[model samples]
Target chain A: MMKELRTAIRAIIVFTIMLGLIYPLAVTVFAQIFFKSQANGSLIVNQDGKIAGSVLIGQSFSSPEYFHPRSSFAGTGYDAIQSSGSCLGPTNKKLVEAVAENLSKVLKENPGVKAKDVPVDAVTASASGLDPHISPEYAELQIPRVAKARSMDVSEVRALVDKYTDGRQIGFLGEPRVNVLLLNLELDRIKKVSNRR
Target chain B: MAGSMWFLLFIYLFTLLVLSIPLGLFMAKVFNREKTFLDFLLVPVENFCYRIFKIDARAEMRWTQYAFALLVFNLVGLVLLYLLQRIQQFLPFNPRHFGAVAPDLAFNTAVSFVTNTNWQAYSGESTMSYLVQMAGLAVQNFLSAATGIAVAIALVRGIVRKETKTIGNFWFDLTRSVLWILLPLSLLIAPLYIWQGVPQNIHAYTDVNTLEGAKQVIAQGPVASQEVIKELGTNGGGFFNANSSHPFENPTPLTNFIQILTIFLISAALCITFGKMSGDKRHGIVLLVSMILLFVTGFFFAYKFEKAGNPQFAALMQRGTVENMEGKEVRFGVLNSSLFAVVTTCTSCGAVNSMHDSFTPLGGLVPLFNIELGEVIFGGVGSGLYGILLYAILSVFIAGLMVGRTPEYLGKKIQSFEVKMVMLGVLISPACMLVLAAIGVVTAGGMAGISNPGPHGLTQVLYAFSSGAGNNGSAFAGLSANTLFYNILMGVDMLIGRFAMLIPVLAVAGSLAEKKKVPMSIGTFPTTGFLFVVLLIGVLLIVGALTFFPAISLGPILDHLQMLKGILY
Candidate 1:
């Protein structure tokens, strides 16, 4: 029994070093050298030398002039220090109240939009609380407001929304989505479009 | 939406079924140690490992000895991983300078991985260092899976060999499982994930400005390698807390498809290997077909309910805008999200692509049902086959009793001792789940994790224990389980769920190995073809439904009824 225990301990130590220490370090070093951009967190760089948001994590956008992403229940909003879902149960009254509160806010924000027309993704806190994309419907809902706010024609902003829209991954893997960060960035770039139908 | 969901489902199934054939055959060859192309390269490595471990490749072990070796090996791994986490602050490659994990959490995480249950009370990117994630968690991902496969191969040997005193050597099975199968598959797939945007660096997290001018932290790590094996081995421990749902870990539709497929690849192939080992490929094929049928049924139920939308949306209900799109990634949509949920839970892999907590009550119930059904619908790698085969044994025993003859499986008698062990194996998890769940609700610490006060609260605790007892690692996302109470209780559940049942399974193998093989006869109960398949499935449902029905009614069923009545929980 003692010998067996000793053997077990030795085997584990050896395997641990091989797999835990050696293998991961090798992969990490190789990736750092070869796949630099991705290995370093796929950070999206803006026009300036400064770093913009990741193409991955969703960010907080409060502008009616900009499109809304998934609701963040992260610390305040989109706080990456802690990542989690609202984890509200189906029957939880707080979840119901929170959704109701969010709905009223959406209604108050969009001057003429009704409560029922609001997309669920717009109101609910996403699992990661850092979901990067919003439903195409949510994006579409904000188009008129965004266009009106930006002094761009409704058609012009709609066209940009369409441009930013990404179909389901590989035709049918995920859902159709519009990256809100990229869309808002595009909205910023479009300083002067006319009423050219 | 429904049409697209169906289309995607068919494509996923088609790819899975077609590909499983070659992979299955390759695994069979690898197990048999037959002349294969990779043999030339891997042979010396395997021999070297055996020599270094002081194991005799030609030697065989009795079932007890095999179980003992496995326990010792896993215990060592458990200790090693535990120590690694405790001392991570002092370890090299800990870019975050994270301190040692609390002893209870360390204990929980250690048992979790060693048992092939990757349940996390703590978030990965924040709490764990890169060193712990790679060396500790990922290493156990490989070794634990190899151990499961080794036990399974030993059990298969017991089934196939006629009155032999021993099963195959544990070391041989472990070495072959890792070297010949898991290592190659993980290596081959890691590059694909990297291409699709999963990171593999040891760099510190990058802080970048958001479009709103708010600061955001993007975590970086050796993700691609860990990501592939986490799925391929059915380990399900994600480098990120959001698991496969996180865009960084699963970026494109291509990565999502690959990830979902990899979850079931080894498990499904092992079914084919089972058939080959039995000298009757049809037996394993029947098991696979049953698994698919159950899987497809659960998948559509989940999809239809999710696509049906929230009935509570009065105005939007008529406008066809009431769908439960909450917590689903629009990048993957409703169909892919539902499919990934069902697929992950159906195996021991619990990597969620969607937040199941936000699913429609019945839709959420499907994933829970899959786990509660013992995850045998193509369960985790080696664990799944052995689990379902236990049902196959019990079913044959049942079928024989109906015909008024002695029960037999693959010409081996299903004696009293074997039946007792099988019954114990089946009963143990449910007992743990129920008892612990009851304890969890009654206790303040467990109650602290509860988000809602009623049935939904019941489900959070139930989900925790089910994930525990099943060795599945996904959470309901609503449960705050990082506390010391859950760490200790669920840690015990994981150990019981894995090892307690495993010991009995090995006992069954031992008992069967000692019995003489009876030749095929007119009176023998069959486990192949349509009738036996139906019987095997019926046995599984009866066991699952009977054991779990009352507790399930209080949670999902009650929640579903309330939702239909326009009552929110």
Candidate 2:
């Protein structure tokens, strides 16, 4: 029995070191060398060289000049650390009221936008509160308002929207969405370039 | 929600079924101790490859030793994944030039995949780099699954052997599981997935023109390899946030079908393997039948409720096209969405071609109920079988008490020590869940996570607990769960919910290993019969329903009633 116990103990120690310590170290080293960008979080930045946010996490943008992501339950909005959605069911009165309130707010902010023109994503919160992108329709809805606000042609804003829209994997997986932070950053850049012109 | 989405979902399902069966069968043969067709055909090739790599395959271990090896392997994976997320900014392959994942999130993800749960607090496309996705997440997908298979094999060994001290070799099992099972199956399935439109390229994101003449940036990766294990292993974390709902992850209705089948294939096949290992194919079939019946029943409810859609939406829309699909993928339709929801939750596989949260109160309840049932309807790979076996032992114990005789499962006696271990394995998660939910509901901090007030809000909390405790990993996503409090709390739940049960299970394995295997007598109750199968299923249902009934009544059942009456309260 003692011999069996000793054998088991030895086995555990040797295997633990090899699997728990050595293997992981090797994989980490491999990841570091082969896939650097992805080994790191896919963060994006602004022209001012400030670390804005990751291209993955949705950020709050209430201004008309920027495209708004899906409604967020994060503290304030789009808090990455506090990622979550409002756990409201479709039939809940609170959700209905909240959606109504949000719609009113969107209408109030973006004057002359038709009620029908408002995108569903603009009103509803995503499953992940940290969803970084909005529906293409939501992006499109903001085009006129953003173009007018930034004093750029609607075509240019539309072009930028087109630029950021990610297609489905292998041309058929997910719905097309525009990363808001990326679009906004590019918007900022285009504005600066036009200013120079 | 949309007919097109339903069409696409059907295609995806078809594809998954087509691919998973052969793959699952192949995996079973590889893991079997007895030589298989592959042993004869692939021995030379395997030897050649091993020789080329200077590999040694002589390592052996007892069942307990094997379990420890798996645990230790994952612990290392957790540390490495955590560290990689912390230091990725300094690493390579980052064309977008990303940085490390936040500490808490990294810890959560590492634990999630290592436990075979694949719950994501962070989105895949944005948070993970290509390297992290492949090495950290994808690698874990394979190893974690192999770990589950290894554990199941250990448990089986305990049942089959008579007074055996050792179960099997840890190193040998792990290697064989990966090399013979996961690899060849993946090799075949990956290409099939590619042919069916799942991506298999190393090229970066590309630019494409849309129907509306908009230029879209398409996210592409080496997806086929990930998809193979992702489904086969039942690790449901998608390459994209939409998960299987994303068209890329599940392109055609055939693929959707295949993906769904892939989720349950190994789990189902493992039952057959169990019977074969026990020298009773009937035993495996009986268990499989029980699981299938439970699964089909859950699917029925989900289908009915979803097809009914929301009565409120019917009243509002006049036409009532809502079909209870507020958060569903339009391509899958109500039927497939409902089916997928039940299957994924029942199996502890979170792959969803449709959003689970969008199902009607009753529709959503089916999946939620499956989780709360302890996911024994073929739960996570190794975890699922052992979980069911634990229940099987419990059922026999209860039966023994009723009949005034010592209980036996298969040929082994269920002693007091084994009973306690099984009970601990069963009760720990629910205890953690109820306590946390109670704290969350009462506290201001907890209430802050509630986005919707009233019964459905309560349901969301219950769902979170159910998902966490069961290790399902999918979420209502409606709850504010990414907070420091939730992160820390759920992370604790994930760990304890996982290892707490695992330790007890390993203890049971050890105890069973030492027990003498008894021969079947006329007085002995045959576990491999329809009667026993019904009894086992009944016990599972009774335990789940009795334990969670009040909670369910407070959440989905009550919310459903209130919705019918249009009552806010």
Top-TM-score structure, candidate number: 1
Off by over 4 Å in 1: A192-197, B313-321
Question: What value of lDDT does candidate 2 attain over all alpha carbons?
Answer: 0.69
Write the residue-wise lDDT of candidate 2 on B359-449 in tens digits: 5788889989898888889777777888898888898888888888888888899999999999999989888888888777887777777
RMSD of each: 2.7, 8.1
Write down the DockQ of candidate 2.
0.07
| Local distance difference test values of all predictions, in order | 0.83, 0.69
- N/CA/C clash count, model 1: 11
Candidate 1 structure quality by residue, lDDT tens digits, B481-540: 888999999999999999877888888888788889888887777678899889888999
Q: Write the per-residue lDDT of candidate 1 for residues A1-197, one digit (tens) a residue.
A: 76567767766766677667776677667777777777666677777768887776788888677777777766687876576677676666676677777777777777788776777777777767778888888887888788787788888988988987887666666777888887887776666233221
